[model samples]
Target: MGDNNLLSIPPTFLDEVPGLADALADEPLNRVAASFPAASLPWALLAQQARTHGNYVNAYAYARTGYHRGLDALRRHGWKGQGPIPWSHEPNRGFLLSLFELGKAAELIGEADEVDRVHTFLTDSDPSVIDAILADEAAHAPGTETIVIRGIN
Candidate 1:
């Protein structure tokens, strides 16, 4: 498994969702599904996990949640989306990473509108954002492993 951990997610949020514990105890796919109910780091993790397991439906759900939450986080930080996300915002990394995930998820789920929206945002934002997220993923893992965000429309 990849070691791309996100920032700490609030325990309260996870606790509020029913069946979280049960889902965690179930098979891997269930755990990923459990993550879909939360609008936080878990969504991003779930998106990646589901995609890895070839569960495109769940991946799309989780990725969309992650993308929306990321956008909300940016909005909270006063991001107008006119340029690259500001470096000072706490969720900058998460938001940028979510865009990559969302783009791929949209493509997998055949959501052309979402793909176009994400692509427009990426085109407007700094190209280096994706590289930074990938670098962080590599840094957290052993050896030269990389996380590839492919076919971002």
Candidate 2:
């Protein structure tokens, strides 16, 4: 849904609507849902875990909601690091692939604004998001930070 359409849907209705995607995400998302804990973790966090372990199924599952659908999240996921992805598992690749999907989806949907958003978010020559990713990546684990990147609207 577009942002306005999303808002148009009543909160109760949105919540009550069953997410068929959740069925696909249930296992791994459940595993890393709580950021090394055992319960109540958000889907975005689990998406991060999916990228970490290269569990593409679960990562794509989780992306249907939350910041995973945001341009900033795409930028973080796909940005090519100055060095290799901090962990052996390469989520950056998935993130990069996901960005391509977003780009194509924007084109198919005629959302040029969204295309710009994803473009500026991911592939810009400027180095801010990349720097932040470098500063924040963890070794042998997925990054769990929800950054507030500025100036990429």
Candidate 3:
């Protein structure tokens, strides 16, 4: 999000454009190559949308990219565990939530092992922070009925 040109397209911008979110879900891979840090959250949201629509292939592609980039962003931020993820730090929050999106995509794609692995990482991360994270999410969650993109403001 720092310098990525894609950030110019705010996440809410898609919400204003009807069918745009669904369109992204329909063809996530077409833009995968050009997506980076700024686009990671959008990809994650698209992955969630794809998952909801039963588009396993697109879900997997977007989820995989989101998970990888999100994980990298978290690690860079000195987060050593998973738990509920600090979903309040701008793009980091989107990346953290992407873990859940990734897990959902993995399940839809029949990647049971990947889903389990993600679950294990989350469960083993830090239970102490879970409640706070969840409360924060609920309090600041997005209004969209689809994938939950908490703390977008």
Candidate 4:
């Protein structure tokens, strides 16, 4: 008889979405989302955009869609519900980004339980991802001016 080990789940690496990069580079985020509804990256970007515009409800909706789509992709790629979704993988960033956006939107919308759940999920997947995502976002922020302080003359 074979032993069933529930503690040894393998890591999941999702396949690349066809033309996703091209569409993201060339099209508006809305159009990109419409073109690639199955891919999590566009939806994640949409959620981030909505959040930036203070549309918390829209952000939540988009992030939710991305989260579910990511879950589907994870299942399709042999993820048995629990594994390290590493942040170092480029293709995995969409799902991780979606989770981050979901948690942020959930917090803004007062979905405290959802926020907590997402936090737990992200940490469980890979504790380093949250900081990685935040750092990436900070690096890409628009009009990010540097401030220098000196003693008053």
Candidate with top TM-score is 4
Error of 2 at 20 (Å): 24
Off by over 4 Å in 3: 1-39, 79-84, 88-90, 125-153
| lDDT against the true structure, each candidate | 0.59, 0.40, 0.56, 0.87
Which stretches of model 2 miss by more than 4 angstroms? 1-41, 68-119, 122-127, 139-153
Compose the digit string of candidate 2's lDDT tens values, residues 1-153.
Answer: 213223222211011113423643665545444332211124545555565676655554554343343334334445332222221223333333344344444544467886676555444322243444344443534455655657966
Q: TM-score per candidate, in order? A: 0.57, 0.30, 0.52, 0.88
- The better candidate by TM-score, 2 or 3, is 3
What residue pairs clash in candidate 3, if any at all?
none
Shift in Å, residue 59, candidate 1 = 0.9
Error of 3 at 93 (Å): 2.4
Q: How accurate is candidate 4 locally (lDDT)?
A: 0.87
Candidate 1 has which clashing residue pairs, if any?
none
Q: What is the lDDT of candidate 1?
A: 0.59
Clashes of each: 0, 1, 0, 0
Q: Runs in model 1 with CA error above 4 Å?
A: 1-39, 86-90, 134-153
